[model samples]
Target chain A: MFEKLARMDRRIIYAVVFLSLSIPLIWPIGLGVTVGPETKELYNTVESLAPGSAVILSMDTSPGGYGELASGAAALLNHLSRQGIRVIGMGFFDTGPSLLETAFGGSDFKNKQYGTDYVNLGYLAGSETAIARMAKDIPGSFPRDYRGNLTPELPAMEGISSAQDVALVITISSGTPGVPEWIRQVGDPMGVPIATAIVAVNVPNMTPYMQSGQLSGMIPSMKGAAGYESLMGTSGLGIRGMDAQSISHLTILALVLLGNVVYLGTKSGASRGGGR
Target chain B: MRRELPVALAFAVGVLMIVSFFFTSEPLVEAAKTVQNWGVIIAAFALGLASVNLIQIHARRIIRGKGLDWLYSGALIFSMIGIALLGIVRGPTHRTYQFWFDALFVPGQATVYAMTGFFIASAAYRAFRVRNLDAAILLLSAAVLMLGNVPIGEKIWSQFPVIGDWLMNIPNLAGQRGMLIGAGIGGIASGLRVLLGIEKSYLGGSSS
Candidate 1:
């Protein structure tokens, strides 16, 4: 049975992996998570925003990354809203508009009327070029709100136009034309402090901007989400996801170790048994 | 002529777009803006075309009696067409369209993204083989970072988080900054090449 199982097909391995993931998700083990510096920087950057300061929330993620970052995005929005900052939400990704609604609807943020306390600019087609044009003229790029009303007519956007009008810019993104575009086109020229929450894969690329002070800070993936959750003192998906992430990580580590050991053992045993 | 004229236009406009960056004249800027607007409209149409292509392929598969998963593809095409119709004809303000988007589109994306939690674990398992000295170091650092990112490691040993933070802040920053500088230089160089027509990758594939 052991020998037969040892030679089990890759599908079985996949099944095991799936079970390893699903079991933890079904019954999670709560592991206390410490907030790292990147997250700390993200928290502090938001905390430091002055009331009435206009901050552009570039919710540039597809719907898929929403589950991982939505709660953190919400907490960040709620924090900004509480501070009395005017939040302008824009999406580069096509699915961004719905994501904005998801993030906003989940909290007290819904009470904040659109085109007043906050505005959703919805999806703009061009990726990086849109950010570039936006830096040149905000209304010229996004002439109307998501609802098709003239943007300038909105009380929220009355004084808000261009990157210069924004005090701080936070880009919640899953990919490119996000933080980099913000840093180059918007944050740097306008002197608006910029921060980002990127998918984990993109974090390495974003760190340089943060270091150079181009991006004031960043939240890197789920771990960054966890850190933001910790700071907000409201446990959400980031915290819950952290539990599943930890268990799954541990399981992988253990499996790798076991696989290596078994391989080495089999090699040495075969050599000895064959009269080495 | 179907592909050639558009391809020529794309090449011409693409060149003008690059050229407009250098010259500050009103005509140049206007040309650039026009090019950009055209790009946007074309890109949007391309997205629609891509989706229609998917619907065609998937619907055909279903029609040919492929498999159980063919139903999944049917669901995809149905939802896509429904949403596209809603977005185009009925408008976003309509309650039925909003309901479909909010309920179906939003959750569908979120569910797919949530799968990353599982995928990341599988990837990490494959990554930690420690095949060489470099691999060993990378594995060790990953472990330190993982432990540092979580609080239990700090409770067990405070140094773990501190070391992890240092690795991320110092070495990670150094490496990333180096890449950024290299990238900036490359980007500018490539832009110059494109402007010179020495590089035509942006013009896209050959017109054949």
Candidate 2:
């Protein structure tokens, strides 16, 4: 029995985990979220943005990370919309513009008119170099918007020529040519405040930047998304997913404990047989 | 002359970029901006270069008609050209392109990412045996972190969140900083090697 238990097929473990994640997602337990200090800082930074101030929302992730970050971006967008801040959307990744379109289309910005309240400058081909050029000359770098309209004619592009004109820059990033790239090319060089909503895997790597005061705020993964949603008084997918995340975590921990127990038992059993 | 000219250009450009940061003179800054713009243009061209390379490799595979390789190669080529033509004709914001991206591409990527959860669970079950003190500590930390990052941890015990935050803030931050600093130093050394023409591997061959 012990051997069988120890040698349980991985398929069973996968099934258990899938159920652990899926069931809670279906019927959520609505766990109360404890807001992290970083998430709170992100919320406060956007809140503190003066009305009519423009902020660059750089969607630098593809769909791989979009699933994890979309809710956080939505919550942040909702907050930005409430504050009536102008958002200039741009991306370094090719898939960035499409992700931004989905984000904007799904958010409270549905009612907001494009070219007025918000505008997407589209996916710039160059990664860090594009960021540097945009910092120097925004209109020069992107002559046309994502929708094929001239950028200078857009209302949101008015009075916004470079990074200096913007109040803050928020990068929703999954990988390289992202937050660090932004900081190196635009934020640090131009003295613009930068924040990020990144995938959870990058949280530890980015925390030091937050500590060093390079990043003004950060939202760490889906849990941070849930915390931000709770603060906004709007329960979105992030809040919904927390139940699943919690259950999955517990399930894995239980599995680890069980595996250790089996290991110890097997070792002791072998020792006793040897003694006999 | 082939290597010397490229190395000299790189050395000059690298030095100018470094100088632009500290000096900030108008002409120097403008010159740096021009170089940066050139970099962007070159990067844009590199995308086209990559596409051509991808097509060439896939086209050869399809021509060879190797086992199942041709099928995948054909699919890849068709998808690439089809998507590109669609976008070129109708623009990316058009319904057809958006539909393909949103419906087909997004979910496919998300599904691939979501499979990590199951893999993690299975891997943890098989590998996280507490064989030694280091392994035990690693297991305990992973468990604590997993619990603490979610809302349920606070429910179980507030201290979990507190301890988790400490783990991330202090030790994690220190470790990450050490890595970042090390990487920065390595990058500078590599850059110097390139500038001095000591690193010719980037030129497609070993340094003499």
Candidate 3:
């Protein structure tokens, strides 16, 4: 039994994980969710933004990272719309603008006027340097909006000369030229507040920034998305996806535990057949 | 002359950028801005250069490769050119361009990323053994974090979330902050090396 268990086919693991994920997704368990302090702070920060205030929403993620971050971005954008804060959207990643378009369409921004309440300033080519330039001169960085409209002509961009004109900067991020770039370029130097909707892998690395208050707040991974969703009194992908996320976590834990148990059993046996 | 000119240019540009960042001198700031704009234009050209490089490498594969290697390369070349043309003619915001992006590219990349979850699970199970005291601690911490981040963990034990937060905020932040500070200092040291022309690795050779 130990030998067979030790050499189990990898396909079994795949099948089990697929089922564990799919079942919860199909019929969500609706487990009770407790909002963390960081998530609540992000909610409160957005809530505190006054009407007509402009915020920079940079979609600095690729399609892969976008898949994970889209839920939180939608929820945050929805909240931003509700508070009547104008959003000036742009992307450091080339895929950012298209994802921004998707985000706006899926959120309440679609109901808001394009040039007034929100606008997509499209993508800039340079990575960190572009962000620095944008911080120094927002209009110069993007003269034309994603749809080819003049940026200065847009109502949402009025008086938005530099990063200082915006109330806050939020990045839905995955890779390089992301949160750290924003911090060095715009946040710390310009005294502009920065926040993020980041993937799970990066959450640990970003905690120090959060602790130092360099990041005003963050929506971390899908759980953070769910917390933000609950705070908003709305249901979307974040809330629904939590069930699958929880199950998958538990499944991985179980696999680790089971493997340890097998290891112990094999080690304790009378004579190991030349060991594992 | 070949190497000296490039190194001198690098030193001058580097010093100029550092000076402009710290001071409010108008001419220095303007020069830095122009240099940054040049960086942006170069980055845009780099994208085009990358596409050409991809085509060159894949075209070779299609010509000389056997079996399905050519097929895969052909598909890659086709998609790259097709998408570039579509975006060029109709703009990236056009529905047809977005359609191919959303229908094919997004899902393809997303699927590749999602598959890592399964791989991680299998790999962790096989490899995460308590071989020593450090390994035991690592495994224990991983277990705690995994359970704490999920709702089901709270259902099992209410204190799991609290412990998780404490673990992350205290130890994780402390370690992360140290690494960040160390990295920041290291970056400055390296920048100084390159600016002073003591590091000539960028010129494809060791420091002289």
Candidate 4:
């Protein structure tokens, strides 16, 4: 058994991981997650917002990271809509506006009025430069919404000319010109509270911002999405995927432990055999 | 003259942006806003230029290529041209344009990202061997983090979340803050260098 384990093929490991993730996803075990402080912080922030408050939802990720971020975006949107917040959506990434369209369709935002309750301001060209421009003059930066409607004409855009006019800025971000970009361009300079639904890889990078109060809140990756779902008392994709994520985590742990055991065993045996 | 012109422009623009940030002088602020707006338009043009560049390189590869390289290049060119034309004519919101984007691009990119999990699992099995004290510490931390991140960890012990919180909030926060501060200073230094014309690489040449 030890010998077979020692020479295990990479394919077997892959197959095991695939099954571990898939089986749990197909039939969930309900190993739900705890709502972390960051997720709660976001919830509290949104909860405190007055109705008719304007908030910018910037989609700063492509489809590659969107799969991971979509659940969190939906959860955040759910709260935003319930709070009657006026959502002014845009994307720094070209894919952002398109994805925002899809996210809105899938979310409760669909039930709300388009121009007044929410509007997609579409994709901007100049990454961080675009963000900086938008900070000073939102209507000037966008000019036209994603659907080719005049942004200034939209009821949601009324009285919200710049970042300072908004209550909060939430970026569903995955890469560069994301959280850090928002922090520098809008958050710090204008003093608007910034929040994010970010990718897992970026969660570690964002901790300091959360601690320093530079970022008011964050929904971190899938786990954060799951936590947000739990807090909302609705089981969405985030909650649905948590079982799979948990099982996968355990599966990787097992692999790592087995790996170390194999190493120790092999090393001891080889040393006894005169460094064979 | 070309080199001198771009360098001078960079310096002026950089100085203008910095000035707009610190001072609220109306003329300077308005000028900076105009420059930023122009930066956006230029960026849109850059995207178009990038597409043309992609086509030129791939078209060359398709002609003077070897083995399966020509096939790959041809496919890339075909996809790029087909999608670009379709998007141009029907608009990106058109059903057919969206169909291709949704059916092909999104899933293809998502699959590529998802496959990393399998590779990571396999790598962990073969490469996560404990060799020394440092290795053991790393392994321990990795285990704690993995367990703490999920529900089962709490099921095993409630303190898992608390410890994980401590790990992230204290040590992780400290490291991230240090890096952010250092990077911020480094970025300002580089920005100053460009503004002072001490860095001319932006003009497609070696820094001075």
Q: Write the per-residue lDDT of candidate 2 for residues A1-276, one digit (tens) a residue.
A: 557778999999999999999999999888877789999999999999998999999999999999999999999999999999999999999899999999999899989999999998898887887888788888888899999999999999899887899999999999978888888877788899999999999988898789988898988888889989999999998899999999988898999888888878888888998999
* lDDT of each residue in B1-208, candidate 1, tens digit only: 7544655665677678667656668888777776667666776788878887988899888888776868888888777777878777976646787677678777876777766655655455444465679977987898787667665567658898899878887999898888878989999887666545566555577512
Candidate 2 per-residue C-alpha lDDT over B19-77 given as tens digits, one digit per residue, 9 for 90 to 100: 98788699997998899889988988999999999999999999999999999999999
Alpha-carbon lDDT, every model: 0.74, 0.90, 0.91, 0.90
Give the alpha carbon lDDT tens digit for every residue of B1-208 in model 4: 8777887899888888988998988898789999999999999999999999999998898899888899999999999899889877887777888778778888899899999999999888889888888988888888888788888888888887788888888888898889999999999999988888888887775666
Give interface RMSD, per candidate.
3.2, 1.1, 0.9, 1.1
Candidate 1 C-alpha RMSD relative to the actual structure: 3.8
Instruction: Write the number of the candidate with greater TM-score, choosing between 2 and 4.
Output: 2
Best by DockQ: 2
iRMS, model 1 (angstroms): 3.2
Query: In candidate 3, what are the lDDT values of residues B103-186, reduced to their tens digit?
Result: 888888899999999999999878889989999999888888888998999999988888899899999989999999999999
What is the C-alpha interface RMSD of model 3? 0.9
Pairwise DockQ winner, candidates 2 and 4: 2
Cα error of candidate 3 at position A171, Å: 0.6
- Lowest lDDT sum, 10 consecutive residues, model 2 chain B, at B199-208
Candidate 4 residue runs with Cα over 4 Å from true position: A1-3, B1-4
Q: Name the TM-score of chain A in model 4.
A: 0.96
lDDT per residue for candidate 1 within A179-267, as digits (tens), equals 87877766765688888778877776777777777877777777777777778877877777776666555666666665556555655
Q: TM-score each candidate.
A: 0.85, 0.97, 0.97, 0.96
Candidate 2 chain A minimal-lDDT segment of 10 residues: A1-10
How do the residues A1-276 of candidate 3 rate in per-residue lDDT, one tens digit apiece?
Answer: 866787889999999899989999899899966687788988999999999999999999998988899899999999999999999999999999998998999899999999999999999999999998888888898999999999999899999999999999999999888999999988988899998999999999999999889998899988999999999999989989989988998998899888888788777763565564
Q: List the residue pairs that clash in candidate 4.
A: none
Model 2, which residues run further than 4 Å from truth?
none
